[model samples]
Target: MEWTAAPARLATASADFEADFAACLHWSAETDAAIEQRVADILADVQARGDAAVLEYTERFDGLPADSVAALELSQAELKAAFDALPPAQRDALQAAAHRVRKYHEAQKKASGESWSYRDEDGTLLGQKVTPLDRVGIYVPGGKAAYPSSVLMNAIPAHVAGVQDIVMVVPTPRGEKNPLVLAAAYVAGVSRAFTLGGAQAVAALAYGTATVPKVDKITGPGNAYVASAKKRVFGTVGIDMIAGPSEILVLADGTTPPDWVAMDLFSQAEHDELAQSILLCPDAAYIDAVQREIDRLLPTMPRAEIIAKSLSGRGALILTRDMEEACAISNRIAPEHLEVSSRDPHRWEPLLRHAGAIFLGAYTSESLGDYCAGPNHVLPTSGTARFSSPLGVYDFQKRSSLIEVSEQGAQTLGAIASVLAHGEGLQAHARAAEMRLKG
Candidate 1:
């Protein structure tokens, strides 16, 4: 079947540009009410019945009937075997990606993930103690496609952060396992893995089954059920973020080839129908050329239908006043992935402040960042990038403030504490502080 791609075209100077832009950018992140309720029930059932519930759900959903959750577990030897069995190219790629991801995360840890202390003149020591999570569960999607990269991106950072146990859960529908995924688990240093998935898998991770150990946090993306389960389990355990549909926004200066920009847009549109890919450029002729390239190149894609639907529904080709205006608009959108496809990408990059990851210059494709560019691929979506960040070593570690007071410090601190405690009408707190004050 022939596929067509026609993204909405808008000029910033047009009076209706605001309305057109809003319509193109709109995507509701609200989970379906039915899915939410179903997820709640699944979480409750798993919390109550533990392994039995997990086994039943795995059979019903994944078509893999396990006698127990233990039956679903993937052993270290199996992971190693998967790695050893891979073709040399696959093995080399996996190891190389893991190495770069590990290196980047190690650098990230050294910069921020550490314990520090400082002493004041009064001999009061104050600082922070940084520590890694004891255990974390990373969910890898194994439904439509297998992502070995997800395994590396999620687990490597945790490993670098010193997480002792990285429990991996990948839903293998019909008991079919992806060797690449298993190989990635081995390469990324996953401590434990299970051929399980869906909200049931999430429930097992969030609330410990008899066999599945409860994790301190859960990271990685999944389908609706997995997302809903994560939302329900947030208080019980930490979650990376509630991700939305993938997005890529290109701020073009018309210097890059139209075909390059068109393919860059296609890179994200193929993710799903809801995924968005937009181009903001000042040159109307370049925008026209890009649209022509999109039309010419889209039909050649294997996922051409999906790209067509995504571009027709949510994508845009906005003609901005200039690069400055394009940068401002990109910040307003705060897209998941932003590409400055321009001659002087660095000049515009500083002006852009709110994307999950910025790919500077035409050559830096978003796909590179998604796979092996070192920085994490799991990023905040749906304008969440405005405040949050990409998944990194920090996500797998926590910090605690350290304080130690000497006699001299307490003497001064106690008097101040006594006044504040009394002001709040807490006599016990006031007396406690007053008791420590020098007479």
Candidate 2:
């Protein structure tokens, strides 16, 4: 592996650092457009043919049999069997993770409000009302790689938000649902679980099929095709952010261990080749040790080939002037996972303004937030944390502004409304206010 030591200050250094930073932000407009076209084609087919189109696409893409729509739905007996099939230890761990996730999301539920009156030369009542979505669809990736954690993260929040119905869809490999995924769906309080996935599943959720009910929103991570489908069906049904490859930025000082840093970097790299694992440190010797540790640890990992390719291709060990510069680089990257492994993480916490999730101290690992930690692992990726947010209970709820004007209040505010409406050439709007004022 090649190790390039970044100078203390890029202002005084060569042009290499600027070049590498620009390469990191290489957004491909062409690639986005191509993916969008494919998604649009899939959506149009599904809309025209309904379940028949969904079945054909599932077989072609997911390597699963195009079974009957009725067979796709999981029965109560199957859910019970999933819970019974697990060993006591695994079951306990899943339950514990579910508890923490539920506790965190439950606290995020928006509460209903009553109308409040304010004096407007007279009196007027105004407030906001919070209501939960009627139904929601959560996509959980299945097959060889089962993400039971995703089931907990997506479903628990909708449940906490008091959504009336929750439908979960997962790709069953060769038409078989993983027992662990089934158990997670049950534990997370999902009203329905379907063995369907890919772009077809997204389409079914967006435009209701005979078997699957249309949902108010869909939330979860999937492959590129699934993401594109969600983007295409956005106006038809709400969607979570378009997540990209996972990323982890570790801001460490000389106090941290090289092995811990190397392993954490590998954790994200194994997710995908495009996944970025970057380390920014003030100490040059620490960077050297981490690079060496990565070499030693790569062979021991199960996904060593993947880790090696990702680290060598997308990973970097950037040496900064000080902790301030290190934090500045982290903000620029806006990584999905940010780890502050310095001596005093609390002091550096104030400097970190743009990360999906922040891990403090050497003890906190990004893996914890992915599974057991209370925070949602479904975070904004690809530098989107600058504007978007992590998934939460608020994603499943809608709010409406409530307004109630008394007769005297309408009379007092009518003149201003009339003036604005007249200025804008909205004669009907002025007349409505005038009628209320006169009444």
Candidate 3:
């Protein structure tokens, strides 16, 4: 309803651009202290009481009546039935999305998931052995909505990497289950699924229960409670990453249509209250045009209030000196989604350095990457893109260092190891190397 309801306008020429941008980018990833303590209590309860606690929490939170956690398990036949029952168009779309996701991860496996070794002149074998996780629990959020795409994104990579057991946990609040999610599980080759969620589900995956097996790692995003639970159970079981709010940064060159850029910003803004959306452009006239378009289109969106809140809370329309300056600012933010909405995206892409996933050109919408795009949609949020990465086959697969020293190779390595170990005051380590040396 309000034209200026989106974000405030800022220009690099102003003295406060740096300060204003910093304020926009600030997002504390810390969980609420109360949530942390509550999660701790739930994890302890689950670990100590096992299936009983799981069932209690399931009933309390999800309002699902179940005598036992075992009863909540969905069979392979049930999953397949859900898939088969879908309307032709929906089923076809799900399959198409899954197929693209699978194809991309399969290529990723070949590129970075294979094991390799090289023998040295002295016959020393040095390499890395790549192996998929034995079992992993994927927590799909159900309280708000079902994400069939999430099922494809998380499970397809693990399946492609040869993970034997892909256990999925989805909260069936009020005894309701989304058939699309189950169908995705079937198509993605999930080994087991449980109608359980929250701290109990994560604890079951981390510590194991009578009905639920402990997983090697846990992946997927959830609410505050789930994020807190994941953090607490980390060392006991591996976790993907503690992601922050969704974000999008657009570096526009004023060539793309203003409406296209406005909708691009809205794509992330609608995700949640904390989600951020920003646009940087050198053309002041075009920035104004995009702002007008955002106002004109805001009321039409189903999630208008949310978009308005997110845009007003964290979004920005910044006018930079040039595209290069915009790219530099983008690096500093390291957004989850970066769109190069220019006539020639490649020209500015090389200037950009840090982003979870980059959407090039005006036609390549960030929405495509979230759904049908071959790339994994699970990406580092907030500024984690500076050091972290998009969830890929690498996240589901781990590596072990391989070292096999030949008899002659041992002589060469042993001498070096002995001196280094002695210098470090580790006598046993020195002697162990000495023992391997030929007399």
Candidate 4:
């Protein structure tokens, strides 16, 4: 089974790589307005009718019986029981992953008391106070897939940021909770766990329900409907970001094993059909080998059809003349997961600027970052790494500026403020400051 390989050839380079890169934006805004409208109606109903509407919608959409919303709440004892039910190895793994995630997020926590004061000649002082949100809601996707990792990633950060209460919402398909998810919630120190999910869950978190209390901010990932609902409820309740389809871009040299790269590419593709998996290699032979390896491995994989469709439609084997070219292309894609399977990953790390989360070297697979590798897996997708960030403790906290001024300082500062206000045609503002200055 010899694979046909192509030799490296330098193609004509284009100056408008940015425009070429900009073309990818066309893939994102395919948001279904009709779906959004339906989700909006459901959210409105849940907000207005409270627990009854939530139960009705959960049943209608999730094909489950409408149980009491109170039943959604998992007790500490129940969580502990779930933990105890797990096999010894599975329990140990969860504990180890939780510890690693907690340590990483603990380091990311901001010092709340941090303050800087600058006094004017008149004894005016100005500073800022960092504070954590009073309460936060974390949405964990449930049903067929149990993401204990999502639980760890979202809750640990909020905990580290000193969020007083962390409420988690997970969809219980057919009105049943995944024991693993519940156990992980307990281990991650979540204050409460609810079996609600989807757009209604987001609404419940945004606008309080009779059973589920409203939170200051909501952080976690969900389906398209949930993402749209979050976008709609932004000001009403703070949200992390509107996540898009998952993506991964691998920059591999000829030195790396093609099978390893192929498996890594499939890792992201199996997430969904919309998920993008690409490979950028300088050596054309390596590119061809990886493509062949993908074909070889696809038939053996559990999600072969999904990966094949994803690879054929969204994935690519981009050929580059050198590692520098590969890096430049990667910066353009700004993939959610970027793997540098090159001989010298550190040497190229500085040159590689845009990626949601980077996996360096052949040994570090994207799966590590997804599961136990100490970084938040709930990262920005659909090239959002260009401007956004992966979920962290900072996302769950807020900062407020502090100012203290003496009478003399107010006189001095108010004069300047009054002038600026007057220039802006704000007479009332000017008069208010003028009165302070005159006093």
lDDT tens digits by residue: candidate 3, 275-369: 99999999999999998999999989988888999999998999999888899989988889999999999998898889999999989999999
| TM-score of candidate 3 to 2 decimals | 0.98
What would the per-residue lDDT of candidate 4 be over residues 140-233, giving only the tens digit for each residue? 9877687989999999988888898999999988867787898899899999888888988998999999899999999888888888888888
Cα-based lDDT for every prediction? 0.94, 0.84, 0.92, 0.83
Candidate 2: lDDT over CA atoms? 0.84
Give the clash count for each candidate: 0, 0, 0, 0
Residue 74, model 3: lDDT of: 94
Q: Which regions in candidate 3 have their CA more than 4 angstroms from the true location?
A: 1-4
Runs in model 1 deviating more than 4 A are none
Tell me each candidate's TM-score. Answer: 0.99, 0.93, 0.98, 0.91
Return whichever of 2 and 4 wins on TM-score: 2
**Model 3 accuracy (lDDT, Cα):** 0.92
lDDT ranking from best to worst?
1, 3, 2, 4
Supply the TM-score for candidate 2.
Answer: 0.93
Give per-residue lDDT, candidate 3, residue 76: 98
Candidate 3: the clashing residue pairs are none
Task: Please list the Cα RMSD from the true structure of every candidate, rounded to 1 decimal place.
Answer: 0.8, 3.1, 1.3, 3.4
